[model samples]
Target: MKRSVLLLLGILLIVLGVVSIGALKREIRISTNVTVSKSEATSFRVLSSAEQISSWMEGITLQETLVEHPENVGSRYRLTQVDGSEWEATVLDLEDNRRIVMLLTDPRAEIHIEVELFPSPEGTRVQIDTITRGSTVFYRTLMPFAKRSILKSQMRINEHWKRLIETSIESLVGEWSGTDASGSEQLFEFHFDGTADWKVSSSAGEFQLKNLLYRRNTLSQPQQLDLTGFQKGPLAGMTLFGIVDLSRQDTLIYDAAAGKPDDASARPETFSESATVYIRIR
Candidate 1:
């Protein structure tokens, strides 16, 4: 009886050892797919914007770009969490309106994320795959639970994106007129195809913004708006990083920092004294 008991104990020890080794060698992977009722171009514009991302990504307070890239292929950002933790993310690859691969790293683990977009009958199909690897055995042991948590987080983020996109698209399709701080008459025409035109008339000159692409995030209290394209006047290719307030009917409280400020951190926090009030005309 003693000999048989000793053999069973030895077998249990061996099995546990094998299990621990296997877990250590494995990396946690999570993949989720969602379809949103928006075009691929619009979806990419929103996804690539750090401003829109901070609104939909839960717990993220800020995302500051350390390096800027026109196509975002080599951009790097520092993401600050609500709890004050920080993570660094670098863009590994990008294809216009198609695919994006990014790597995020922290003290505990490294995460590789790849997002692929496809045009679907419903709208745009987004596939997100994340692979997380821990730096220590203790962290690795917790990865099984972490995988489930990450999956839930991704799903929730996608829902936020869907709601923001749908709400903004419905609310911002018309002509709006306002007066800027300089007393210039400003006219903005937003089209359903995700394009817009800005015409400003002033004593100095008349300026027109052409080939503009607008993306909005209505998830936050004061909605966020971004306008990117070339300008026909002195500003050239300045992008508008701004906010919109739609609490009152037929009114839009617009405040924006013209051109790319020093960084995303330079975006306006609230309606400044220079805020332009716009009334919907059409």
Candidate 2:
């Protein structure tokens, strides 16, 4: 049987997603939470609904291959990414606006991947936690070494969604609110036509709200994003020497410890942590 490169790649993507354990209970849980310029509820609403996941994970190519685009309990799908990596994932659990658990079962790469979306005062936080319990001692020991580096890279890849959305906002698509969940007023008439707001400063350097704008164009294509209102504040003038590519996904927030670049006078000078928000804001 002839196999297309995409088909074979899709098969391997899913295989790499799993890190097997013979008696390890078939479970591996690792998570990374990231904040975007959206809501916990809204972020969950999108990501938790596995059907919409490909919007943020555009690199995955086989999403449309799922049986029903199933996202509910026990819903399963076989997805292949742009690189031809594929995985067989089953929906293990789902909690609206809180959590979504996905299990990828492949002997070569058996593991559990759970992703959570959080709404913060600063932005929409996303957590991709994973769990991989190896069955045998030899298998378990080698699992981390074989997978952790790749796992970290996966987190950064997903982080790219935040960057993509912020770019849309900075490009001036529309208005967005980055206030954390605590401040969200149900009373306000807010609509996310996929818009965002951004600011520049000395301490944090240049940071946009993490509200990723997701939308469709008039032709109903995947043009789902908008950003606007670029402003500078007190922190805008601070000198920045560190860096974080909010535009790049998969770079986990907790893991990104480098400082950022900031300049009040548009010329490098004094800088401080105040120039950057510890979290990866848009």
Candidate 3:
């Protein structure tokens, strides 16, 4: 009887161990596909290296390279956030433009993220899989809640990539020209350096433009073109801001307006009644 009781106790302990281990680990997967070529989609993922994560992630301010690798795998990076928190990540696997896997190590837990790309009928399909593990009991209990947040973060990152692939900077470069409602000839020259020049020929005489800057806003649907400038000459230092709806088509449209200034500057107080359409010249 005593021997049988001891054997039973040992079996119970083994069962408990397996259950505890299972409770400490969790996995989540999400996928999204966009109307972009596989090459474009894959390029976006490759460029999102540890060093360039801050460009897409809102709170990340800096990323430091801890280890360098020729094929990207085995490379380790440290990322610092705006709130002074930091996390360490390592590249676990990389298969050229096909897939990338990263291991993110935080103070509370560790997560393994895998991103895979495949060609699709529409364009490219991207799938993200995340596995989270925690050693402590407290963290294990919070895994359910943590999983929700992790999924949201993953979706946000994927959306950023989709927007970037849709409105790639390369496609926006070159000269674009159009005419306004009043038959004014408008010319915009977008340079590779992110600077643009605007020339408007109207009955009111050509308005000199300065401080032209163009940026693509990835957070919005259909994406957005953010144009900033200043009217030169007597209206020097006057602010010009325009939010243009960006479409992947050949034509882009927007309404340019002069922002109100506290200082004295002879600038237009209101924007044009109709939107101006610009067709790609090159």
Candidate 4:
């Protein structure tokens, strides 16, 4: 009787293993969409550019081209994540200003991503579809529990891209002035060449305007101005990250506070704080 019981247990284990292996081999697909306030051509341009793609995907340090091509099809890239993980991606298909399909090769699994852009009255509607299959039995068993988180991450990526395409550099060029929470006078000058100047006056007297390199923060919510100081001044060699809201064509609301840098070597000594409503002075 004991021998029979042991044999049955072994058979049960083998059956469970087979079931797990089969489940792991199953493919799953997820789809999501986001709307951006830009023409389809503009949106497609941003999506295809490696630099812009890296900026839109938060925590991705950079993407280096392994193989480059003018047509974009067959182009391969190596993506480096913030955590130092790496992945290989290849452009499987490309339709100018319409669609892009990419294959991501990772150790755990292989994923295919398809992006489609449609023109809308508000701007461009971006649809993203991702499909993947688990490669290992352990990974397959975890897929059911992990699938939701994976879909959420894809949604977040789309949202980041949407925010970035909506607030291009062209929309930010000009002069704006406002008052801080402390009733201090604040002024900002954004140039077409991607440079900016900021000045603020408070009880401590007026601070000199510092030259800054400004770019759109693609990773942040509601979109914001990413300012990197250039010369030696109060904000020299520092980043003043701030949120920008266009209340109207003529009015802008800006808010920012101090924060620590992710890289210790790049940390700055001083920073500034402000929450002001700016009117276009230009």
Candidate 5:
């Protein structure tokens, strides 16, 4: 009877081991592309260039720059994160204003980042292909979970890129200032109940535009918003909507699709029509 019991336990263990192995073998893949339309190649070219890489990729800020000069094919650069951890990457291929591929590594983790750029009806379509392969038994087991989490985070990251790209657009063509463009002298001062201010604006007449967004972090109660809208004409009913990242440096304005006019402020669903100063900052 003891021998039969031991044999039964051994079979169950083998079946569990088989199931675990099958689970680990399953793979998850995610891909995303964002296009900035009608943009000159210069914008994409400058971003991929070595000189301004850090401006867009904030993570590079935490690393120590161990290599300098143009990162051409076969060139390598080393960086160390804040915790004294390190990553070494080498440029594997480059085509001016078209594509770039690099292999990234730290002592424990490895990722390949490929950036491809092409013209689109709206602007330039930037395809970022990221394949992270882990070498150790632990990281290999963790890769699929990591990949799933990272893909969700990518959506938020794209929104960040949208804010930056919108900023770039405004830098190229000045903002559609309220008074001159829309004939409204609305003294819009969006002082959040906390500390942070950054937004995107596009001025195309008679079109709905999502002008501003703000977020705040507070311990006393739920965060809040304060806006002073000034307009008496057609845009008096226009509304503003946005998302605020408590941990981020900027807010994302949910403008309508790039080609279409922005959404008007009066949408009852997921929009607030009134603007009032809950607290005055003297």
Candidate 6:
């Protein structure tokens, strides 16, 4: 009876091993996206900066470069966590201001990540795709759980980046004084509360254009400016897509279309002869 019982226990162990092996997945993939109110160049710069990694990436205590390659391709970085765990990341591909692909590895698993940025109506769209494969059977079985955790981390990182970029918009706050095409005195007041107004003073009289809203993407070439919510005039309730040159803090080179373009490419590429030149008054 003792030998028969031992043989039955051995058979049960074999069955359990087979079941565990069958549960292992070959790989897991995760895709996450975020729309940030910054230019594509700005988003890519933040994402690729090693110095900023710890600020947005959760639990990373430190990061150091192990290998350096020109243009960032083939560069390797070592990331250390608070718990003393470490991971190595190697840049596999890079497209300046466009896309980047990385290979991340640890003892237990390996991950391939691709990040792509595109110009969006909001500012920039960031897309992150990752494929995870385990080096051991134990980790392979845990892929599903790891995928969920990684996705949450990615979303958190994106939010952190968005906040970082928004701070750059503060430079445009305050009032600017300029003149319209007819040489009428023009005043633009940009409030931190996200509301703005265009006030005009002419021999006719002083009147304010109410219900105006303004947004800026400072990192874009020629810098992007959008004005919406015009309460009166021909552009009432329409967005006027515009560009500004802020290279000089004391002056602003501002140009906007009289009306929204059917396509973004049709927007102004350079300051026109009639572009309004504004001097910072506050």
Tens digits of lDDT, candidate 5, 1-282: 999999999998986665565357443355777766424333444444454433332345453345554435665666644556657777677664567777777766676777777766676677877776666665565665576676866666555655555444211111112232334322223321212232323343243223333332233122322221313343353433322212221222222111112542332223233321121111
**Model 2 segments more than 4 A misplaced:** 1-29, 52-59, 64-66, 69-71, 81-85, 133-141, 164-282
Mind giving the per-residue lDDT tens digits that candidate 2 earns over 165-208? 44441221222223222332111111323332343233324444
Candidate 4, clashing residue pairs?
Answer: none
| Model 5 residue 9 CA deviation in Å | 5.7
Top-scoring candidate (lDDT): 1
CA lDDT, candidate 6, residue 80: 89
Candidate-wise lDDT, in order: 0.75, 0.46, 0.62, 0.70, 0.46, 0.74
TM-score of each: 0.54, 0.43, 0.47, 0.52, 0.47, 0.54
Candidate 4: give its CA RMSD in angstroms: 14.9
RMSD per candidate (Å) reads 10.8, 18.0, 11.9, 14.9, 17.4, 14.1
Clashes of each: 0, 80, 0, 0, 9, 0
Better of 1 and 5 by TM-score: 1
lDDT of 3 by residue, 1-282 (tens): 999999999998876665565475543344443346534323434444554544434467788888887556788888787998877878787654466677777686777777776656665576666777765666765665566776677677777767666545324555678899999999987654467787889998886464487776556443445555555564355544454653544466666555455522322223456878888654
* TM-score of model 4 vs. true structure: 0.52
- What is the lDDT for 53 in model 2? 48
**Clashing residue pairs for model 1:** none
User: Compared to the true structure, candidate 6 yields what TM-score?
Assistant: 0.54
Q: What is the lDDT of residue 110 in candidate 6?
A: 87
Name every residue pair that clashes in candidate 3. none
**What is candidate 4's lDDT per residue for 1-282, written digit by digit as tens?**
999999999999987876675585566788889988776655665776656645434477778889977666787888888888877888788665678788887687777889999877786799999887777766666666667888888888888787777665325555678887788888887753467788888888887565577877645455676677646655555566667766354577776644433433332223235457888665
Please tell me which model should have the higher TM-score, number 5 or number 6.
6
lDDT of 1: 0.75
